[model samples]
Target: MAKSKVYFTNLRASFGRNLLQKLEKLIKEAGIGNIDFQNKYAAIKIHFGEPGNLAFLRPNYAKVVADVVKELGGKPFLTDCNTLYVGRRKNALDHLDTAYENGFSPFSTGCHVLIGDGLKGTDETLVPIDGDYVKEAKIGAAIMDADVFISLTHFKGHEATGFGGCLKNIGMGCGSRAGKMEMHSSGKPHVNQQLCVGCGSCQKDCAHSAITITDRKASIDHSKCVGCGRCIGRCPVDAVEAASDEANDILNCKIAEYTWAVVKDRPCFHISLVVDVSPNCDCHSENDLPIVPDVGMFASFDPIALDQACADAVNAQPSVPGSILDERERCHHDHFTDTHPDTNWESCLEHGVKLGLGTREYELITIQ
Candidate 1:
């Protein structure tokens, strides 16, 4: 009910201290050391930029967090779940390859990278949280096994959720394959006949015999199909796609509930870097120019407050020249809405508040 404290620091440096050192100072000042990290398995959730997308947070920043966790005697690991889309990171092996390719290795980050959902994207631990929408959340087993959870987010804009921040990183990013399917769609995946080569990959992978190949084309029997999302991942030709039919508002709320499933009964912390400010998710293989100038770095015990502060800071900045925000008509005073007219990002934070995640009101304390 009271205002949460969100700590901040701008991107400035002197000879004696650099940005990494500043990040170390910022998190400690924000009370990361207050958690009992001794001998605990800590999971620092992050997005290792999809192969070609260069806007993701660099591994150097992750090293700072890992070093601090080690200093406190905790076992720390960088983690993220397998994505649902057909990409380089759809399964554990490929996901690790992408992470290493993006320069995130135990050698670079001072820790290991764990694909939260395991090799097939089906390894999950279901947490029961009876909410208005989701009854149970399927999260990656490794993520849920951690005694402590921390979100190290690359704050940026998204076409669906409006902005990807702490909650998005923890909620949607932690979901296993089925969890992502549930959040993104109300129905099972369907085949695009034009794209299907009828390789019978989906047919062979379907555990329920829902997929059939006829005349070099595939069709799914929805009645027999369970939305486990295996066929979407197994398709070699990218012919299968999840039906993104959920309303953006409903999707936002589901993300909040999934976040609750992840952080409940666990010690958690959050940090967001409002740099790059990419106009779309890092899931894309490419990143556009930043829509706004870099704001700063933020840390907080409250994920809701951290997200709200980051959004407010971004909204206050002037739009970057030639970026999407600058090119838009600016009809909506809110930058996120003006850039993505159909999405309502406020729905996530409001639902987070209603679900007792954290308070939106915050006191922004600047750390020089």
Candidate 2:
């Protein structure tokens, strides 16, 4: 395959020009206008920073992307799926509240905020992609419903995937509760006996008769359970929990496959801002100091290439003075591996290339 084009622009500003303006110029120059957006429902996938996490991308940047979509005659909405782990964004109600509290309202972003998964994170659309790790991917309903998909990601370090870039943002970020459970764990969920109030809600929701309640507690029969994660959403007390025992390498591969499920047969665009280069995921309630200095913004039609470009750029930068990367013993030459010894982000990119998502080789064009 030919090298894909990834456009880039540094975070330099002058009078009457700012980072938002630069983002607009970068995407347009990267060929965002090539897509037919007229009358289309565009989903701009993004992470509304976890409550108290100050490292997430600002709402003002999202507004620029949404405004551009409107300019091209598309209806845009900011979206993200609920997290598998318990947090401020575990359910739609709490998710929306967090979005608003973090300044991602319809008024602020010039578009409505839609929690990809519905009320309890159970509303999903199963996408069949015969991947080595995943046979069928369960994605949030609202995300799959969009006519056009765009990933606006905050490029940063991740403990599991090494760095959360385009593929990470779209693949892992778009999965519904069950989808995430499938990606993170190789086993089925177990009921928390203490949280189960003898509520047969989980038992009633299981389609495969995999859940059984006895003595006011629920237990899952692994033989019958398909790991669809329905019981996790049905439990009133949030008792059903997925076991995250998958190794980091397998998890990265699964993330790539999930990404393929989302962008298949759709017009998808990707943009990543390598700013606030935090040492961990934005899912954390708090952020550590950036491992590297802010790089800039990148945009591409090919997400795999976009991620490769971003990762390469980040690795080239010097480590921040007092950040985690600075304190670590830099034996591995690679920043991400040195920061997160157990993770191999290249697994996701390699798997993505093999899956025909996009090429890892990219032509980085600087947008002045």
Candidate 3:
């Protein structure tokens, strides 16, 4: 396969030309505009950082892309799928509020914010892809409905997948809440007796009538449960939990397959911002010191190649002093692996390559 071009831009800004200017230049250089944007509904997929997390990509960068898309005649909209975990983003209303609170608004980015799944996070489109792990992927309705896909990822570490890069953003991020359940576990969610409030909220939402409350505690009947994962969101206390026995390797591979389902026939453009470099996912409400200095922004026509390039750039830099990486001293070569040892992010990349999402090889073109 030919080497994919990953365009880059540093933090430096000059008087006549600034980093933002270079960002536009970089995207154009990567041939993003070559995709016919005329009258297309372009989905600019991104994670509207959890309420208190400050490590997410700034709306300023999004504005750059949104403006470019409009200039190219595409109707762009900022979007993300609902979270499976109990948080402000579990439902569309709260998710939109959190997004607006976190500075993602039409006024700010020259586009509107869309919750990909739907009002309940259950509205999705199941796309079939013959793969090693997942046979079909449940993608968000809005995401799967887009005419063109553009992933704007905040490259960082993840607890489960070693690192949350372009693939993570596209795969795990694109999945509906139920899709997340499929990727993360095989068993249905069980009510945690200690956290259960017995308010009957879970029972009210359980389509299978598997939940019951007695002695002011909720209980789930596994025999009747359908694993739809609706009760997990209905519980106000986050009393329901998915099984943790699923193998991590399997989960990563499934993530790649799901990502494949999302971008299979779409003209997709990918961009990853290696700033903030947090030790954990943006799903966390809080962000720690960066593991590395603000690297730069990268763009490519290939998601896999863009992710590999971002990981390589991060690994090449020395760990920042006083950062979380400073507290540990092992496996210094792989930054994501150094943070998360058990997860092989490469598994997702290789799987994505085999699925033909993109290549693993790339040429970094700096826009200095």
Top-lDDT structure, candidate number: 1
Cα lDDT, all candidates = 0.95, 0.94, 0.88
What candidate 2 gets wrong by more than 4 Å, as runs, is none
Which regions of candidate 1 fall more than 4 Å away from where they truly are?
none
Q: Could you give the candidate ranking by lDDT, starting with the highest?
A: 1, 2, 3
User: For candidate 1, what is the TM-score?
Assistant: 0.96
Model 1 agreement with the true structure over 1-368: per-residue lDDT tens digits: 99999999999899998999999999999999999999999999999989899999999999999999999999999999999888899988999999999999999999999999999788899999999999999999999999999999999999999999898999999999989999999999999999999999989998999999999999999999989888887888889999989999999999999999999999999999999999999999999999999988999999999999999999999999999999999988888988899988999999999999998999999999
lDDT of 1 at 271: 94
lDDT score, residue 203, model 1? Answer: 92
lDDT of 3 by residue, 58-107 (tens): 89889999999999999999999888887889989999999899889999
Model 1 pairs whose backbones collide: none
On the 0 to 100 scale, the lDDT of residue 294 in model 3 is 87
